[model samples]
Target: MLASQFSSRHPSTVALDTGLSLMRVAAPIIAILLVQDLFSREFDRKLHLTSLTYPRPRYQFLLGRITAIATLLLFLLIILASLLAVLTTWISYGYTQATPPDLGLPYVITVVFIALDLLVVLAIGTFIAVTSTTPSFVLIGTIGFTLVARSYSGIVALLTRDSTLVGNADTYQSSLSLLGYLLPDLAALDVRMISLYGDWQFLPDDWPLRVVSTLAYAAALFALSVWALNRKKFS
Candidate 1:
């Protein structure tokens, strides 16, 4: 009862969104602020490594820095995610002429998936930032991830599917299903089609597969990011 009630709460950026807003805003946090402090900041023209070796209040300094960076990013991302979600909702609604269609469940689901996807993005950015010791590398990696995911999504689908179904079938269901399954599968996670026009739910048997695939993708990406961070030798 309690869980359902909480779930029923009005749609907001923090709740359903996979935290894309935070991830989007997090670039400045990692690059501008955190990187400057951790990699660039120096007392007197000395290397940051100097402080690392001769640390004073090392633990407190690091903790405060991380907290400040994360907090700044969190709200920024929340706003961004919320704005995009609302924009998508408004656009779809205008096209469909359905106000709060399907009790706004599709909107709800889309927001949630976007937020979850951002969690993976954040993990990648944070890990890269810490491991590379330079925010430039991390920012580049994050942008690359986004571009690859968005661009390849359509190409992969076209190459995988038979010509007959390519035009009408679900984008992910075409030749792209393999890569779609491998990466975030933003196509599947995106419920925009439903918002625009109804009759879009996946079958019961395949629904579980979708859930498993998404969970696996998120876990795999997050684990890879953590692995990269763990191997980093802060020197």
Candidate 2:
């Protein structure tokens, strides 16, 4: 359905754009499930107790679980990015766009940013898994986190552009702006336009800040998860 909407554009560009968009949604769900399985299920089935019996410190166990989940996500992202690249290339074999889509560095950067975005989701999921008593909260909390973190920036921008759009635009913008500090703006990490249009103009001026913010947010959540796990009791 989405492909048909983009039928007027370059097929390869459309394919890459649509594929990455779908991935932006799918990756978080996959990461949530992986974190749930790694952390939540272990607690649920009492397997965590056996793992805790090892000589290693609780932090090591938590870190090891995080590492394993991150490695799997990286592997999956690589495979999907490679497949998308190949598919895009194949589609563009004979045809040519007025402005050729960049399948080079731009595409690679887009994929990397997407991976970073997924890492934020993974971190949140891991945090919830460690901190929450209910296994179901891990899924629900992470999904809610992703939705708000990804869209809040856009919502705030809309409210800013037209204050009359809302009855209490000032209050809402102030609230979301405060949240902007607390949440990593995952929307800014979206660099798909750079790849889709092969235009440097689409490159975010504050990309370095965005990258740092993402890493810092994920690292903070991870540290909190480690802290929670170290103190967690399996009753």
Task: Record all residue pairs in model 1 with backbone atoms less than 3 Å apart, i.e. clashing.
Answer: 16-112, 17-115, 18-114, 18-115, 18-116, 19-115, 21-77, 22-77, 160-175, 161-175
Q: Against the true structure, whose lDDT is highest?
A: 2
| TM-score against native, each model | 0.52, 0.96
Model 2, residue pairs in steric clash = none
| Candidate 2 Cα misplacement greater than 4 A, ranges | 1-6
Per-residue lDDT of model 1, residues 1-235, tens digit only = 1111233332322222333334434544443444345433432234545655654644444445545655665565556655655654443332333233332565555455555455555545554555554446665776676556656766655655555655655554554555554456544545544433333553233655666766676566546644654454554
- lDDT values, one for every candidate: 0.49, 0.89
Clashes found in each candidate (C-alpha, N, C closer than 3 A): 10, 0
lDDT of 2 by residue, 18-64 (tens): 88998899888999999999899889999988889989899999898
At residue 163, give the lDDT of candidate 2. 97
Best by TM-score: 2
Considering summed lDDT, which 10 consecutive residues are worst modelled in model 2? 1-10
How many clashes (backbone atoms < 3 Å, residues ≥3 apart in a chain or on different chains) does model 1 have?
10
